[model samples]
Target: MQPRRLALANQKGGAGKTATTLGLASAIAARGGDVLVVDIDQQGNATKGTGIVATEDLVTTADLMSRAETGALERAIIPTPWDGVDLVPSDISLGNIESDGSNDLVFRLDMAFEGVDLSAYDAVLFDCPPSLGKVLFSALIAADGVIAVTEPTIDSVEGVQNLITTLEGVRRRPNPRLVLDKIVIGRRRNTGEHIAREAELRNAYGDTVARTMIPELAARQDAHSERKKIHDFRGGRAVALQVAYDDLLDELNLTSSRVQEKGA
Candidate 1:
């Protein structure tokens, strides 16, 4: 079977989309499942968080999207410091797609994966940019599923609604098979507003909202700063972050059979 491809997206900044992308990748890697994180965001936070800084000569997601090369997909995959996880790193150059104005621009990302075997990875995560632009549209067209990452706030909730609308439009034409897999509540805090917003999301999304919420923890940032996975980090509630992600993986059905057998 093909690997599950997911686009972790939120147009609103500070929604923890990048963090969640790496966190889930770390979780899957810790379980001995391979993961490929495709960083399509111009900020390249996901690329840097995984200790990758794509140089000018390197083939990145931008190279993959620019043209339909024979081995472009293979060239873009780079192994990171984390075991069992690879990356298709992106940089500022990815922003050029917005202005390219090619009729086929939106389909280029999907074309990049064509005829390429991706069964090596258990999951492929795309960290989309914070906008409803061509980049995000291309990712939606390319991915099999979308995971909306958001904080429990008014703006974040609204952002999820907007993304859902955009996703619905994409499904109608570009990608009829695309599914909104889940709405993840990230960087959750124990405040009245947060609690109320969480309730609002669950009420609106029902079981589509993930039961596991990523709590506000400093260890996340600490691990990212060190360019290490949360499981590899040694300080400041790292265990808590790991546990939260484990629960989140369970909710997404990403834990491999080997990991479950080992745990059992």
Candidate 2:
């Protein structure tokens, strides 16, 4: 079965891409859906966030990208400490691999995920690098749709537009079926300024900006340091997050799964 891949991308940094990716992947897994997180960033923040240690001993994306056959890549897939989730972790070697002129980089990642059976997983989350590079293109080709995370600010909004243009350009060629299904405005607040920004984004991009606005909660940030997901403890954070993710999935008519209870 073709796995529905989602990329949490933004041209600007600190748009909560990593946080969104981790939360969604973990949430999907918590709901009993098997999930895989591909850490495409050279920084390996997502890898670190998931507590994947990288001291050069482990096989990583670097090895996979350079290999002729993805046998090594599939071998590198690690069942992370996270339940119902597996990872093709990133590492420092990723810095040496440039997407600028790689030979067929787009199809490269696409093939990496091919052999594996994605039927059990409800989704595959690609934590993309913060640039328009081979990794993003590759993820786009593999993904059925993408969710661009934008903050409630103008600079971030501008970056979001540029990202869309870049994706549009890619779709014109290698990823003709690629659909940037929705733009997510995360960390929304109740201030008048926030409302205006949201309105502006809606006016600018129309309905592509999803109706689900993830509220900024202190606990969401707190969960990070604990190496825990916001979905774990119930309350405002979990309810709001669940609503946003479920709304996005509903918009796409996608199915959700239930994972065994944590530590069961």
Candidate 3:
């Protein structure tokens, strides 16, 4: 059984896409399930957050995207400090891939995983760049589902709608199997604006929006800075974040048994 591959995507920067990806990975691992995180963002935020400092000689997502080769992704997979989690890291050089003129560039990421078995893990997550570019398209082609992560700001609805348009395009052509699995509201606050936006989103999307909303808490940033998982970080309301991510994991049905049954 192949693991369910999902892309965590939102076109707007600072929308907490990377944070959600890492948080979910931590949650899955803490539940005794394995997860592989593919960091396609040039910023390498996910890589750094997982306690990895990629030096120059390491194989990265850039290498996987540069060409269409079978089993290349296996080489890029490296162990992270977190248990039951592996990573395909990225760096600033990945930015150059957007400019390449190759007509097959968007399909390379899918090709890179050919002949590689991913059944050992519960899920594979693609941490996409905060843009609707070639990299994002590639991830969509490779993934089975997408989790749209967004904030409760005024413009967040527009951002999610735009990503939905992109997903429609991908489904029409490149990946018919790709599905928009859920819309996760992240970095939420108790302010009136946030409350209104959240209500608007639920009204617009209805049950497509996830029931679990991740709150904006200082412990998230603090854990990222300390290179620790939210479940492992103790102090300053970290327990809230841990509970949120755990709820999200269950809400998304990302547990090993559920994912495997889906794959089967």
> What is the lDDT, from 0 to 100, of the residue 68 in candidate 1?
56
So what's the TM-score on candidate 1?
0.96
| lDDT tens readout by residue for model 1, 41-110 | 9999999999987899778888777875554577688899888889999999997878887788888888
Please give, for residues 1-264, the per-residue lDDT of candidate 2 as tens digits. Answer: 556778778878888788788877766665566777888888887787777777666767766676545434467678876777788889767766674466765676777666766666667788888877666666777777788988888878888988889888878987787788788888888988788889999998899988877788876676666666566645446667766655655564444322332321
Q: 244 in model 2: Cα distance from truth in Å?
A: 3.9
lDDT of each: 0.90, 0.74, 0.92
Measured with C-alpha atoms, the lDDT of residue 257 in candidate 2 is 27
Q: What is candidate 2's local distance difference test score?
A: 0.74
Q: Write the per-residue lDDT of candidate 3 for residues 73-166, one digit (tens) a residue.
A: 9899999999988999999999999999899999999999998999888889999998999999999999999999999997766899999999
Instruction: Sort the predicted structures by lDDT, highest score first.
Output: 3, 1, 2
Q: What is the TM-score of each candidate against the true structure?
A: 0.96, 0.87, 0.96
Which sequence of candidate numbers ranks them by TM-score, best first? 3, 1, 2
Error of 2 at 224 (Å): 1.1
Q: Which pairs of residues have clashing backbones in candidate 1?
A: none
